[model samples]
Target: MSKILDAFLNENLEALRDQGLYNEIDAVEGANGPIIQVNGKKLINLSSNNYLGLATNEELKQVAKKAIDEYGVGAGAVRTINGTMDLHVKLEEKLAEFKGTEAAISYQSGFNCNMAAISAVMDKNDAILSDQLNHASIIDGCRLSKAKIIAYKHSDMDDLRTKAKEAKESGLYNKIMVITDGVFSMDGDIAKLPEIVEIAKEFDLITYVDDAHGSGVTGKGKGTVKHFGLEKEIDFQIGTLSKAIGVVGGYVAGKKNLIDWLKVRSRPFLFSTAVTPGDVAAITRAVEMIMESTELHDRLWENGDYLKAGLKKLGFEIGASETPITPCIIGDEKLTQQFSKRLVEEGVYAKAIVFPTVPKGTGRVRNMPTAAHTKEMLDDALAIYEKVGRELGVIN
Candidate 1:
C-alpha cells in the first residue's frame, strides 16, 4: 500500500471516530432470524430487515439446496452471454405477476437494480422529481442517470405537485419521472402513491416506486402500489427479493417495452453475472408462497402492532410508522448509540440510526419486528427496552 493512501485512510477514519460516527460491524454467528447470536450472546434481534421471516424458511432452504444440487453454485457469466437460465426467466415472470406488471427484470441486488434501471431509461435531458426521503439506492441511481434531479419535500403531495408542474412546464427536458420509496425505511411511513399517481397523470410524468420494504408485508403481500390499488398506474415498480422475499436479488417490474429496453441497455445486466440458480429458485418459491397465502403477512402486522403498542405504552417516543419498522426516537446521537449498546447488553439487538442516515439530531434506535418474532420474544424485547429507556432517562 502507498504511504500517501495509508495517510489519507488514517485521517478520515480518525475523523469518523472523533465524531462517533464510525460503525462497528458485528457478525451474526448463525442464521439471521427473529433472534440472532452476536459476540457469543443470543439476543432478540430487532435490526434485521427480514420482514416476513422467510429467510430461514425450511421450504425455501430445501428448494435452494435442491437447485444447487441440480444446477451448481454460480451463474458462470453475465445475462447477455449464456447465463440467462430457465430459473431466471421463471423468477422474472413471477415478479411481473406479483407486481401486476406486464414484465420484470431481475438484478443481483436491489441497489444494483436501481443503479441499472434508472440510468438505463433516464438521461441528462430529463428531469427527475425525487422524494427527499427516498432510499440511498434511489438517490445514487438518479445521480447516475445524469438527469436533472429535483428533490421534492418528503411525502408532501403539494410539494410534489408543484415540482411536477414546474418540471413539465420548464420544457428543458425530454421526460420527467417521479421516483419515491413505497415505504420510507427509517420512519416506516408508506408513500402517498394515490396522490403521486394523480400528479403523474396530470403531469404525464413516469412514476417509479421502490417498494423494497413494502413487498411481502403489505397489500396481502402484493406491495404498496397494490395496497393502494394503483398497480397499473406506476411505470416502474422496483422490489427486492432479499428483504421480505427471504432471498437475494432485486427486480424492476413494468411494461414489456421498458423491460425489453432494460434487458439490452442496463449496464449491470449486460456486464455483471446473473443471480445464482439457488437464489432464483428460492426467490421464485418465496414469491409463490406470498401470493398464495396471507398467513405470514397477517402475523407480521400483528407483531409490529404488538411491539409498537408496547414501546408506546412504555412512554418511549416511537415515531410515525405505518409499517412493522419501529424507531425509538432519542435525539442525542451519543445517547442514542449508548441506548442501543445497552439493549444489546441486555439481550436485545436494535441498531442506532444517527446523523447522515436520518437528520443530525434525530438519532433513533430502529426496530424491525418480523413475523418470525414470537409474542414472548417481543415481550422480552419490550422489557429490555423499558429498562434501557429508564436507565437512559428516555422513559418515565
Candidate 2:
C-alpha cells in the first residue's frame, strides 16, 4: 500500500479498536444452519439472515446439482448479452408469481439491486423521500440516484405525508419517489405501507418498497407488499433471493412495464453477469416451496415467539419486532460487543451489531430464529442467553 493510504487505514483501524467498534469475523466451518461451527466450537446460531432455512435444504441441493447437469455452471455473460439463460427467465417469472406482481427483474444481490434499480429510474431532477432507518443498500442507492433525498422519520406516516406534500408542492422535482424497507431489519418493524401508499397517491409520488427481510417471513411467504394487498399500488417491490428464498440474487417486482424498463436500464442487469444456472434453479425451487406451503413460515413465527419470550423473560430489551427478527438491545457499544463475545463463549453464535449499522448507543445482538430450528435448539440457545445475561449484568 502507498504511504498515505497505509497511514489512513492504520489510523481508522486503531480508532475502531479503541472504541470497541471493530468486529471480529468468525468463519463458519460448514453449512450455515441453526447450529453453526465457528473456531471449533459448535454453537446455536442466531446470527444469520436465513429466515426460512432453505439455504441448506437437501431437496434444493439436489435440484441445484441437477440444474448444473442440464444448464451448465455459468450464465455465459450479462443479461443484455448472451448471459440471460432460460433459467434466468424462469426465475424472474417465478419471482413475479412469488411477489404477486405483473413482472420482475433479477439482480446479482439485494444490495446492488437497490443501487441499480434506484439509479436506473430516478435522476438529479427527481427527488427520493426515504425512510430514515432504511437499510444501507437503500441509503446508498438513494445517494447513487443523484436525486435530492429527503429522509422521513422511520415508519412515521405523519412525517412521510408532510414531506411528500412539501416535495410535491415545491415543484422543484420532476418526479418524486417514496422509498422504505417493508420490514426494518434492525427493529423488525413492518413498514406503514398502507399509510405510505395513501400518502403517495395524495401527492402522486412513486412508491418503492424493499421487502428484503419480509419475504418468506411475512404475508404467508408471499412478502410484505402482498401482506398489505398493495401489489397493484406500489410501483417498485424489491427483494433479495438470499434471505428467505435462500439463494443468491435480488429482484424488482412490479408492473410489466417497470420490469421491462429495469431490464434495459438497470446497470447491473445490463453489465453484470447473471446468476449461475444452478443457483437460479435453486432459487426458483425455494420460491416454489415457499409458495406451496405456509408450514415453514408458521414454524418460523412459532420459533421467533418462543425466543422473544425467553429473552424478554430474562429481562433483555428485545426491541419491538412484529416479524421473526429479534434484536436484544444493549445500550453501550463495548458492553454489547462483550455481551456477544460472552454468548459465543457459552455456545451461542449471536453477534453484536453496533455503530454505523445502527445508531450510536443502541448496540444490539440481533437474533434470527429460522424454520429449521427445533424447540429444543431454541431452548438451549435461550439458556445460553440467560447465563450470559446474568454474568454480564445485562439481566437480573
Candidate 3:
C-alpha cells in the first residue's frame, strides 16, 4: 500500500477519534432471534428490523434448510450468465404477486436494488424530484443516475408539486421522476403517497416509492402502495426481503415492461451473482406467510402500541410517528449516545441515531418492537428506560 494512503487513513482516524465519532462494533454472541446474547448477556431486543419476528420462524428455517440440501450453497454465477435458478424465478413471481404488480426483479440487497433500478431507466439528461429525507441508498442511486436531482421538502406536497412543475416546464431533461420512501425510518411517518400520485399524474412524472419499512407493516401487510390504493399508478415499488420478510435481498415491482427493462439494464442484476437458493426459498415462504395470515402483523402493532404508551406515560418525547418504528427523541448527540449505552448496560438494546443519520441535534433512541416481544418483555424494557432516563437526568 502507498505511504500516502496510509497517512490519509491515519489523519481521518485521528479526526474521528478527537470528535468522539469513531464507533467500535459490538458483536452479538449468538442467534439474532427475538432475544439476543450480546457481550455475554441476554437482552430484550428492541433494535432489530425483524418486524414480524419471522427471522427465526420454524417454517422459514425449514424451507431454507431444504433448499440448501438440494441446491448446495451458492448461485454459482451472475443471473445473466447461469445463476438464474428455478428458485430465483419462483421467488420473483411470488414477490410480484405480493406487491400486486405485473412483475418483479430481485437484487442482492435493498441498497443494491436502489442503485440498480434508479439508473437503469434514467440518465444525465433526466431530472428527479426526490424527497429530502429519502433513504441513503436512494440518494446514492440518484447521484449515480447522473440526473439533476432537486430535493423537495420532506412530505410537503406543495413543495413536490412546485418542483415538479418547474422541472417539467424547463424541458431541459428528457424525463422527470419523483421518489420517496414509503415510510421515513427515523420518524416513522408514512409518505403522502396519495398526493404524490396526484402530482405525478398531473405532471407526467414517473413515480417511485421505496417501501423498505412499509412492507409487512402497512395495508394489512401488503405495503404502502396497497395502503394508498395506488397499485397501478406508481411506476416503481421497491422493498427489502431483510426487514419483515426475515431474509436477505431487495426487489423492484412494477409493470411488466419496467421489470423487463431492469432485468436487461440494472448493473447489479446483470453483474453480481444472484441471491442463494436457500434465501430465495425462505423469503418465498415468508411472503406466503404474510399473505396467508394477519396474526404476526397484529401482534407487531399491539407490541408497538404498548411500548409507545409506556414511553409516553414516562414523559419521554416520542416524535410524530404513525408506524411501529418509534424514536425516543433526545436533543443532544452525546447525550443520546450515552442514553443508548446506558440502556444496553441495563439490558435494553435500542441504539442511538444522531446527526447525519437524522438531522443535527434531533438525536433519538430508535426502538423496533417486534411481534416476538411479549407484554412482560416490553414492561421490563420500559422499566429500564425509566431507570436510565432518571439516572441520566432526562426524566424525573
- Locate the minimum summed-lDDT window of 10 residues in model 2: 79-88
By lDDT, the best candidate is 1
C-alpha displacement of 206 in model 2, angstroms? 0.2
lDDT of 1 by residue, 202-296 (tens): 99999999999999988989999999999889999999989999888899999999999999999989999999999999999999999999999
Per-prediction tally of clashes: 0, 0, 0
TM-score preference between candidates 2 and 3, better one: 2
TM-score of model 1 relative to the true fold? 0.98
Off by over 4 Å in 3: 1-3, 18-20
What would the per-residue lDDT of candidate 3 be over residues 1-396, giving only the tens digit for each residue? Answer: 899999999999997655445555678887776689898899899989999999989888899999999998999999999999999999999999999999999999999999999999899999999999999999999999999999999999999999999999998999999999999999999999999999999999999999999999998899989998999999999999999999999999999999999989999999999999999999999999999999999999999999999998999999989999999998887788889999999999888887678887788999999999999999999999999999998888
1 or 2, greater by lDDT: 1
Question: Model 3 compared with the native: what TM-score?
Answer: 0.98
Clashing pairs in 2: none
Ranking by TM-score: 2, 1, 3
TM-score of each: 0.98, 0.99, 0.98
Q: Cα deviation of 137 in candidate 1 (Å)? A: 0.6
State each model's CA lDDT, in order.
0.94, 0.92, 0.93
- Give residue 335's error in model 2 in angstroms: 0.4
User: What are the per-residue Cα lDDT tens digits for candidate 2 across 1-396?
Assistant: 899999999999999988879999889999999999998989999989888899999999999999999989988898887988888888889989888889999999999899999999999999999999999999999999999999999888899889899999998999999999999999999999999989998999999999999988889899899999999999999999999989888999999998899888889889888899999999999999999999999999999999999899889898899998999999899999999999899999998999989999999999999999999999999898989899889999
| Candidate with the larger lDDT of 1 and 3 | 1
